[model samples]
Target: MREVAIVAFGQSDHVRDSAQTSEVEMLMPVLHDVLRRTGLRTRDIGFTCSGSSDYLAGRAFSFTMALDGVGAWPPISESHVETDGAWALYEAWVKLLTGEADTALVYAYGKSSPGDLREVLTRQLDPYYLAPLWPDSVALAALQAQALIDAGRTDEAELAAIADRDRTAAAAHPHAQRRGPRPAGEYVVAPLRTGDCPPIGDGAAAVILAAGDTARRLAAAQGRRPAWIRGLDHRIEAHSLGVRDLTDSPSTRLAAERAGVFRRPVDTAELHAPFTSQEVVLRDALALDDTVRINPSGGAQAANPVMATGLIRLGEAADRIQRGDSDRALAHATSGPCLQQNLVAVLEGEA
Candidate 1:
């Protein structure tokens, strides 16, 4: 098997609204930034992949338009996923593993401002059972929170603390949308307050992947350490909410084990837990103790860009490893309700 690593990572300044900027426009700058970081150009990329949602962009095949920024005019080896960018990154990693590409570019973006994000996300539910009912994302998350509380796993006050701590930690994160300490505010749902939820935002993020010698060369040229991916895996739970336990995430635990999370202690973890209560569930699933630093970049609670949020978690973890802030790290991304789908990757700097 070929070794792969993240050589570069960059993201746009996440904002509550980016209505003025088109998706292509928002992506162009980020693409330029990441390529410049590694001294590479669009033409140098071996493969390119992206992630986005048509529902959020209010159009079919919206990801095609975003490709304009990459200048695919000459044609490029590319693909896309209609979900979060983290999944797209997963695809690119596999591409590298096959030795089909020496360098791969992966990016994801989302603009949740124009539509009713809550209702739009409901489209992901089962059409026969849940789609028609139209339960908003927050309400669905609230149901999970209440379950955790009833199970004596966590309570409202602890959820509030998670919210406050994460957003506050984002104070120094340049691309973060929500920062500083704020009131937990009123309950949007019975067990969840305003701060307990992630801010609706528009944002983009990009990462560069290289395999084996190519990975080392890219990082060496930039005088930076490479964040090597030791293991990666994803798992999904039953789609029917009634069939699974909301207070626990067996899928997460399974993915973590497959990704080598339990093999050794990771000093840092970037979790894509959009809701405070979900963070509690992930903490237990990943078996993280207080010794581990969780979400130093604020995770999704600080700036949740939906499609791009998961990718950002991986990028933040890799960046920390590259910067010598951590020796090994755990990065997790999720899709669907109540952590139904989970992806985990264990990254480490050369020891």
Candidate 2:
């Protein structure tokens, strides 16, 4: 397979609401920023892929409207996913590997402010059973949190600590919506405090991917290190919430293994665990020990942009490697309710 690396990443300052902005408006600056970091223009990109949920926009083919910011006037190879931006990155990775593209631009965004964000997420549930129940994101997460508590995996205090650590770590990330530790607020749902849940926010993120020699060249031009894609894979659990184990994530474990997460020690990990309690399940599943620095960018718990949160995880991990802060890093993204789908990507700096 052709080697690929994330040479640049950029994101907007996440906020509770971007009421005045359109999707194109929110995306333009981020797209400009990522391209500026790499000194590349839209026409220079060989392949372009984006991720966004039509449900979030409350319209069909919403991604196409967002493409106006991409400057597709000249025409180019492009695609999109109706999920998280990290999945778009996955597609771009495949394109590079196939030698169909030497460089790719991947981006994703979410404008969750316009609707009942919690209720909007419930759209992903089973249309037959779960959808009818209308278990909003936090409620479903609370159930998982309760199960973990019952299984003796973790309790409220530990979940609180996870929230504190992730948000505190974000103090240095200017783009993070929630920076610095805050009190674990009152429960939004039983066993899940307000702090335990991710902030409903709107934001956008973008990344530039280049293959092999092209990857090295892009980084060199920017005077940065390339966060090489050492391995990458994604796996999904059973769709039925009843049959799946809420206290564990077998799919994440399998994806991590397939992505070569265990080939060697990873110095840093950026997980897309939107809820604090989910972090417990993920930590156990990915086998991330105490030694691994997790969520230095505050994770989804700190700055969840819905469709863009997962991509930010990969970007945060890659940024560490690019800055020589980490020799090896792990990036993970999850979609669907209660982490139903998981994608794992391992990154490493050059020799």
Question: lDDT for model 1, on a 0 to 1 scale?
Answer: 0.93
Q: What lDDT does candidate 2 reach at residue 340?
A: 96
Model 1 residue 309 CA deviation in Å: 0.4
**Candidate 1 lDDT, 55-111, residue by residue in tens:** 997898888899999989878999999999999999999999998999999999999
Q: How close is every model to the real structure, measured as TM-score?
A: 0.99, 0.99
Candidate 1, position 206, lDDT: 97
Error of 1 at 228 (Å): 0.4
Off by over 4 Å in 1: none
Tens digit of per-residue lDDT, candidate 2, span 18-70: 99999999999999998988889999999999999988879988889899988
* Residue pairs with backbone atoms closer than 3 Å in model 1 (clashes): none
Candidate 2 regions exceeding 4 Å error are none
